[model samples]
Target: MQDKTPLTPRFSYKSDRLKPLRAFCQTVRLGSVSRAAEALFVSQPAITLQLQALEREMGVGLFERSGRRLTPTREGQLLYELAQPLVEGLDGLESVFKDKVAGLDAGELNIAANSSTILYLLPRIVEHFRAEHPDVRLTLHNAITADGTDLLRADAVDLAVGSMMDVPADLSYAPIYRFEPLLITPPDHPLATKTKLELADISRYGLILPPKRQITYRLVDLVFQQHRVPYTVALEVGGWEVIKQYVAMGMGVSIVSSICLTDADRGRLATRSLKEWFPSRSYGVIVRKGKYLSPQARAFVELIQPDLFTRRDYDDSGHSER
Candidate 1:
């Protein structure tokens, strides 16, 4: 009854203990103390000390180390699950407020895109954005489409610009540009003389393709399989430029996105449209479902699609008729 007067808790909003919480969350998010230190602009020892202090205060081990990787324990996982969103919200609050007040003059925008998109599509967009908002920090993470989706899910990137064949349930994709698939061969190759090209015709020669693990390779494989065509992989290169280089070198022909084709390539290579043989690919910006876009991200997205933010046509599944 006397205790009903109520007790004041020792913890307060301005407590220094929250620093350790931030360190813990960053460590968990980055999956290593070194990475967390780099992101936080602190020393590795400082991050380690913060984690140790947090573990001591909580009386539990948070992370287990294996080789260079730091894996969260059950306690760590639970703590992260409960603490991450709050920490991010609090940390981003100042930027959000300033962005609201300043009208997109400041803050950071992180983008994930593959090498091809970065090479072909982003230069002009980035130039435009830079001209408009010089104060905003821009970071481009070079990741393939699959890895880009992973980055989007992890909140590592603000937005991703790439080609996605299958959209995941938790993500939204809005295509801004479409490119046809093309069969590229060296200027002197036998296929260069043929205007009416078919899958069977392309299959007769060795193909310089992206790695078999990539979606492009899978799409190529599926198209050839569906047509009952047998193709040989002479070399499995990584980038479109490399594939194009090899193709131009007369090593093998390649099926590549027309987005990668430019005026410079016209002189070195022979290109024939494969639109009938392969579906056109859409390169677009992908974002997480229910994600709150920052002012910078919103501005960039608007550049991609003027009505992307204003339009309510997108449903929970992230699909729209447009």
Candidate 2:
């Protein structure tokens, strides 16, 4: 009646609806109910039941099995797109609250980067972060592109700092530094003093390069193939430092990024710009597509470059975070 009785609530007050939403979102996120259960510290059957309740409440089929993996239905994907941010925000609430009250005093951050980045790019940034927030714990994992991407997808690392050539849809990268490609040779090498150089000129000498699996080798291979230039590898080893050392000893010449060059190498290695032949590599920060960055993580990332991930566009440059 228009009198004292109130209408029934649209939302069920007897049970918390968040549990079901969390179960559904996690199942969709992980593509496996068991994995979702493990991630959420719940039983498999409980996750299954919550998912069932959520599907029934929404009156739609949410998942269909594709071989061993659970694939979300069209409606389910729409629901997931709408609900996942809510779940992540809710989950990160405590971290956000702590950040507001305590700042970066006692949080932790994990980052993944390759050896070169760790050696050259991160030292200053890391030192500054440590100086500003002494109580915050920071860990850096040495990882290449593939390993770093896997770590981000698994939520094992808060972010990664590296260079990427092809950005996948599920990751975000923000490039902060641009370095040119350079040809490095021992000061006494024949090509070091050549006035006019060409690809053929460089191909005349054996090259000290990273392994075939690394992008540098692949890029060198592609460039040579495109120009129909034949070349030999004097050594196929990893690590730019090692490559530089061997190049200095006249083991072989190398094409390397300028980031690795320093005043220390000027006496031993002759440098020539190869930017015309090779694309400039860009290095930056990487984060998962839908990840909610903790305040500690955010502070560290912004410390490097304030403009990254401003509008939450992951892989904004459509390039990988290598």
Candidate 3:
């Protein structure tokens, strides 16, 4: 069998090898040496040695080991937080240099977004981009709010559009638009007759909500937690499409972003503003830290004209909801 013993713990040296820093950040984020090693594409021993050298240089223990897992010390946590953006900037710098040398013009753009963007934002942008660069292909992927950012980091997509909260270090974001969440129900649903609601009254019905970890769900939970309201979740689905369909079928009422609505859906589902609910859902364009945006991709991003809801061209563009 291969040797599994850990090598001697040597503290980090005062050298400028960024390898150790990268390893440290990954380990802190993932809480596992093996996982960090795999991410960095280095041997476990190499990663360990670098960390040891780094610890020696810093003169403080960075991590506390407990059986199989590793947790960052307070200092380590602080350092990891500071280093993430710096590392991402460095990665972006390197990519810019490589792109400068390659002399490439047209390339593909991979965009991942929630159905809301697919419905409200993409059509006009796609049309404008195609008119400018007919040769370049623009592909957009759709996911629930939770999975959008992960898909960007995993290289499953080049850019993502969704909630900007806790965006990863390896990604850059540009705010595109903002809107508020609304309570929606089938036109004849009990809540539709009313123009507004109190928390207790809304909570009385079975709720169709996004999973607790999802961004929208967090917002909803925060409101409930702050108001000390009790509510029952009848179903937790991942996507807005599913939620809308269920609400349309009279299964349950849903709290959804206003961007999820369309003219066709307006009559089918009655939307009521939640005055106490958070008034904004801000979405952005997220790209990998070091990836070069092709000329076409650059153009696409530039054409994403941000405007207030009253000024939106949603009616004329006819975007099909995904």
The predicted structure with the larger lDDT, 1 or 2, is 2
The candidate, 2 or 3, that scores higher on TM-score is 2
Model 2 vs. true fold: TM: 0.78
Taking all chains together, each candidate's TM-score versus the true structure is: 0.69, 0.78, 0.73
The reply for model 3, stretches above 4 Å from the true place, is 1-18, 64-95, 101-104, 164-174, 287-298, 305-322
Best by TM-score: 2
| Stretches of model 1 off by over 4 angstroms after superposition | 1-95, 310-322
Candidate 2 global lDDT: 0.83
Which clashing pairs does model 2 show? 163-322, 164-322, 166-320, 167-319, 167-320, 172-315
- State the RMSD for candidate 1: 6.9
Full candidate order by TM-score, most accurate first: 2, 3, 1
The number of clashing residue pairs in each candidate reads 0, 6, 8
* lDDT scores in order: 0.81, 0.83, 0.72
280-299: candidate 2 lDDT, tens digit per residue: 98998887655677767877
